[model samples]
Target: MSLAIKPGKADLHWLLGAMLLAMALHFSHFPLWTSALIVLFMAWRLLLQWRQWAMPRLWLLLPITLLGVAGIYLQYRTLFGRDASVALLALMLSLKLMESSTRRDYVILIFAGYFLTVTAFLFDQSLWVGGYLLLPVFGLTACLVGISYPHGVLSNRLRSRLSLTLLLQAAPLMLMLFLLFPRIPGPLWGVPQDAYRAMSGLNDHMQPGDISELSLSGAVAFRVQFQGEIPAQRQLYWRGPVLWQFDGRGWHMAGNDHAVEKLEGLGEAVSYTMTLEPHNRRWLLMLDVPHILPAGTFLTSERQVLAPMPVRTRMRYNGSSHTQYHLAAGLGSRELARALQLPPGGNPRSRALAMAWQRELQTPERIINAALTMFRSQGFFYTLTPPQLGDDAIDDFLFSSKRGFCEHYASSFAYLMRAAGIPARIVTGYQGGETNPVGQYLIVRQSDAHAWVEVWLASRGWVRLDPTAAVAPSRVDSGINTALTDNTLLPILARQDHAWLRKLYLNWDAVNNGWNQWVLGYNQQRQLELLSRITGTTANWQQLMLWLTGSLLLMALLLCALLFRRKRMPIDPAQALYLRYLAKLSRRGIQAGAGEGPLSIQQRAGKLLPQHEAEIARITRLYLALRYGPHAEPHAEPHAERKTMAELRSLIERLDC
Candidate 1:
């Protein structure tokens, strides 16, 4: 028996390769165990392909699939949500790979690969992510083309060139669709409550240590684009949830029982656009008091803008915030009472000290000054590491250990103010941001997380207070990283001093900023802004759809025309002379038939024209030698056949006409 075999039906191999690549890329985003299962399945498929193992029986596959589904349900605690659905899709792809033995099975794998690509986008569309994903996407596309054209050897160079060309050709249309497509208010199908609940940002309540943990991360929380002048770093206080009630150790938002009746009156409003990253948090970050929000946002009684749904994707909202706003036109007694509530028993020494100070200083400003003076003059240190305290955490921090982060100072300050009969709340959100010189836009990261206090004045509206600033003045003026220089949690990349590397990173960030603003962050407001700038009109859904469809059709037609254009054949001198001789023979009543070979036609023509028989035979012999003989290279005998055909044509022309 012969060990060597001809290349028979390589479509199966191409399909298997595509499926493997798809499975790898798809499961990369899933959990470790899920990815492990996919890897094992791929190995099994490889073993089967190499003839070392066989595919699982139908009975075995059914039970395994059921167990896989059960494992997913156990892990996620449900059969729904984005993560679970993605896992199920990955499992199905793996199972399909195991059973993929035919050409049609391979086609199904290719389509699955495309669907997986879209699913990855649903997770994240960052420029680097989108760019990195192109490898698998192109690989799968090439595998598809290879499977479809299985007769020829798979050409890596040709496939790469063709795949890149196709992607480039499709990019403009994809961008057009992404831009012109109308966005609808979400939950078109109601989203699961736990779709994306793990991301950290401002929660419903501001706790003492909440912002501290947030301050350690380097992830971008949101980005702001100023309409006019950007606000100063010290003045850039992005107000989020305001916590009124304090429980000695932590802070909590006012309960619904003490809900405010109405929004405050707006004064001078600062108009700007904020593109918020997805935090799985509904609260939209803006300047102090936002008077106007983009179409889909709503204003709460606390003067905070909120999205109707949790932001699982990057969102852009245009907001006009009032630097001076009168909150709660008529202050409700219940609301005031909730703001004044504190834990009944904890921090007794701190409470007694606060009461003694309040008796000495009657005014709120005098009390605030005393608190600030205490924080500044007590040899207090601003440090990330603070010693653990007992039940009286506030008393221990204020009197014993004078080292703590912003949350510690903010919490103690709020406790003292409430003890002094001044209604104060802990305001939590990012404070100062690093201004990117390249883009001239504020880049607020998780490290910018900050907390301060807002005390209600008798005549003046809420006034901002920063007890942390009293201890570390640099934190208020500069970014948090500079203030926390001694902290180990700061990003190592920021500490590097390579000028070229820094510049490259910043330039790359500028590109990402542009991509986020124009692509990922493009929402209803951005769409309207773009369409208005282009067409000078508010484009409706129908009009936008028509424009998008028409543009896609035009692009498709252009691509088809370019791909199917006729290829012109290169003309050689020998072929030109041979055609000339044939023309001479045609005038003499002798013409070649379509199916006749050159030798037979030459013999027949020689017989018809006896005087030119020798010349005809010479030309025919040279043409046949070049056409049928071994080692007859076209460029080797340049113009030799042309000279012979020219002489034969002259002889035939003279003999005939």
Candidate 2:
């Protein structure tokens, strides 16, 4: 009952556990030193409790706290933003545990644990993280219950059961708010700017090893669900940034001119919905020759789709693409100049070969075919681990090493095209995808990263060509796993050897896809659509607010009814008879004292009324035996206790008051 009372041992243990669980969620994101300090502080607090030591004095605590703050600032360069703030919160909570002795401190720690648990979502909102957070939430709720008791002596089983019951009771209210609350346009919370860094995907620059290095990662780039039949692996060329500016060693994206694209679909367009994971880039990797762009996106002069803002979160958009299309057969003079621009001088051998091909073939089509034939017949090896090249990288790959990944082949082929007077550029994007039969969708991973060449001809415009396909046809037909003879570098999910593991992964990914589409992807539009379907007409924000308010009030009333419902205490037959006997004595002005035992009351009654002494003594003896004697023991026969109670009741009924 006293709020200022020191917390009991059980309460302290619960507080420590709740803090541990909350901090565990962030350990992976925290710096190593920060995580180490958190663990050290928690261990010190536990030792203090174990040894029954006093709290650390202010002089001892103040300096350590300052040092911790300085360490955090040094690690993050500032004591602000999402990373630093979360680290400071976690460290301070552990420090708070050192002095958490009172019920007030216990309550503060429990609430702080709740806040810390919610912060984990700011970094990751995946289904696994969301499900794991319930653990800390339950621990904090149980700790709250522990602090409410004066003695804090509740058994762990009982406490856990109570916590589960509370969560279950709150589930309806949570669901109601989630469904009916007015939906917002952006994320539920405002994340810091630093939250978008370190995301994995293709970048603007593509060196010889850029795509090869990215091919080693198994992280999902995007998932596509087709409105019609899924496209073949070779046709699944998801186009990203087009690199027109090639340095001697690397290729970079050109300046965004925002030129209107001229495209004509030659075949039936394949409609599909794309759920792209954030790579902190503006480019939306749509399939090749996308005629219908998603809303809020536009096609560049080179047919690269661009969003207005960098995607900092998982997003879903709808677009249709034609496998066969004519894209920008005609280019402006400026575009033409930029496309043909390359490093002034390098790869002399490569340039000489291209010139010879130009003189011999004299046309773009024949020259391109000659290059492909040479790659196919010249013992060119397609490998993930290509030897490092020197300054003349293109000449080295073509003349000496002849071993490279897709980027190497594409870069060399594009250079040869430019040297031969054909406008050519490198297109970097994903090449192939694996279909998840469970979800009936295509999952394109970073392992499918690829580079190909696009050459412009006089009449046909820019034509898509993949020199890697010429060297290793399986690279496009199957996947990178099948294309590489040595596939040990690939992630287990990307390889085909572990059939059972891949199946399990597919099942899990399918569940995650559903969670992404129906849970995380639920936005303002989804809310409006769902409401319109539920009602006969379209529901606006005002109607949503009204429904939300009404649902909340109704939920409150239901909770109140459940909480305040009356409960009847079971009556004991022996106690009932004893109380009746006492009432009879009270009527005769011979009431027993508050603390009087049955024997004492019987003796007093006998002294006051000698005629009823024998009956009174017998009744008292039978009642005592039935309620508290050997017959009352838990192991005693229930029938015996009932028989004794019946005898006592009969004797009391026979006695006169």
Candidate 3:
């Protein structure tokens, strides 16, 4: 009999489901226009699949591809870097979906989906991102299984279930590999310069509205877990880059020509560790004055820490920061001149006011106090929406508008101090962070980008003074979100008043803190520390590799045994019963042939043993029924066949040769 073969609609539904999921994830990383193009392409492809419209011609696809490439180049200024390349890959995947008519095309698309999964990790490795990425991977695996095995009744569901099970089983092994894997010193390949240039964490220089833009983003900058004691919120000064030289509007890094020569001459050290997130910048943030550093890191005479290479990924480093350390004890005239330099023109009103204040005070300390008092007493508002300043921003901010973020107040304060001959510079970095109670760690977000002023006293070195803090003390004690109650400036968290949600948010932060510390923050220093922990102080790479290989081999052996144990021996209960029946019939002269059917064997047996003919017929009928039935009833007892088989065996024994 010939079986009819027809394609099922279920396959169509499965393919569409996979395509829709892939499209949703791919669109998230593209521009608005690119996303619109993908939506149009998907609708067009669906129409073609439904026979409502024809597929686009080959000639049409060429121009579309060229247009997409051009669009990516235009959007990112170059068809390079992590963002641009990912966008291009997403576009190609979408285009491939339009022409995916064959099983091979589907397979290629599934592999592309896996590549996209890894690419997403390159962008962000947070726990939340990892959780979101699992969906597409699962969908793609289902599509792969459905296409490969179309006829099996439970193939698609079983394949997906088994795949997830296998992945879960392998997770422990993956973690083991991740922990024990040797870390290379540098990038394996030359990364693009603009790979992740969104300018996260902190910037080296501060403009009028630089910190304002940074405060809008809710991205996390870094997480710190104190070893000995957590510093008070007021004392938490995470110093980043120091901006000394200033033009009319913006501030830049000071020239290092007058940098101090040695750090050993500084005061006592206060040791601490920091896990810095990727900022695409080389400046490292420590407590205050870092003395010791990892192998590739160096310290400048200005007491700023520098990494040998620009940090493109999460980095963890240990340092000894002495908050009381005196830097550049004997400040040279050249160095003092550099710190005193200011923009010649702008802020003329503020300059004249400073000169007048200098005449009254005649001391740097009193002048600094006066400026702080002015910020506090002048009704200056600390707001996200600050009024625009003219060429003389400081004059306008101090006299007319009197509304700005931390950078504005800081820039003006530093300029006024310098005008009074007090050596001052602008320090930019995150201020207060939300302390995660669950993890006992401080989680610093990008919203904490703050700029404060530091005035150099002859006896006190560079004494920190935050004029913004004097105006808005809540900003330094609590987070910026709490300080700025404007609903327009706060993120989604500000919309809700749920206590449970707040706890959930804190718990989620704790999980991300662990992920960043162990996965993204894993480095050469961490690797050596891990090795030493696992194999004592004398651990080496050769011994670690040997242990790793042995453990992997043992795991492989165990997994093989579990998977193949059921199929190793082919003697199941039904087959064993059939073999026994064949042996019983062979005792008589009528023996079953190798390829003979049950009916044929029964006919041959009837001729040899006429008395047992009925018995043999009953056994043959039941045997054929069980073997050829649409569904086998293994649990049902074969009563008649069992009696007949016994009688047949007796008759065969009576006719022994």
The number of clashing residue pairs in each candidate reads: 0, 0, 0
lDDT string for model 2 (272-350, tens) is 9999998889899899978789987887878788888888778899999888977776888888887778778989999
Instruction: Say which candidate scores most in lDDT.
Output: 2
**Per-candidate local distance difference test:** 0.74, 0.88, 0.74
Q: Determine the backbone clash count of candidate 3.
A: 0
Deviation from native of the Cα of residue 365 in model 3, angstroms: 2.4
Q: Cα miss at 424, model 1 (Å)?
A: 1.1
State the TM-score for model 1. Answer: 0.86
Q: What are the per-residue Cα lDDT tens digits for candidate 3 across 1-657?
A: 112222233444565565556556556667889888777876677777788455577899989999999999999988888778878887887788676776676777778877766676665567877787777767766666666665543356686796588677778688778777777776432257565766576776788888998888877777777777777776677778989888888898976665553433345456666778778788887775566775677776676778887877777777766656555546778878988998677787888999998999998888988998998887998998898888887888899999899999999999999888888888888787777789887777787778888788887677778998888888888667666758467554432356698689989878777787787667666777777887777667786687778778887898788777876567744445566667877776567777988888888888887877876776666556555553255665677546544554454345432
Stretch of 10 with least lDDT, candidate 3: 1-10
Model 1: lDDT equals 0.74
lDDT of 1 by residue, 1-657 (tens): 121222223444555565556556556567788888887887787777678466688998998899889988998888788778878888878887777665566667778877776666665567977776676678677766655554565676776677678788878777777888787755232246555665668787765466777777878888887888887778788988777767667887764454543445555567887878888777888887667777877666566667788777777777887666666545567666766788888888888988988899889889999999999898999876677877888988988988888999999999998888888888888897766779877778877888898887777657778998999988888767667658567654333345787678778878998998876666676687777777878766676778778888888899889889998888655556577778878888888899788889888987887877877887777656555553256455647655655665565455442
Q: Give candidate 1's error at residue 582 in angstroms.
A: 2.8
Model 1: residue 570 alpha-carbon error in angstroms: 4.1
Clashing residue pairs, candidate 1? none
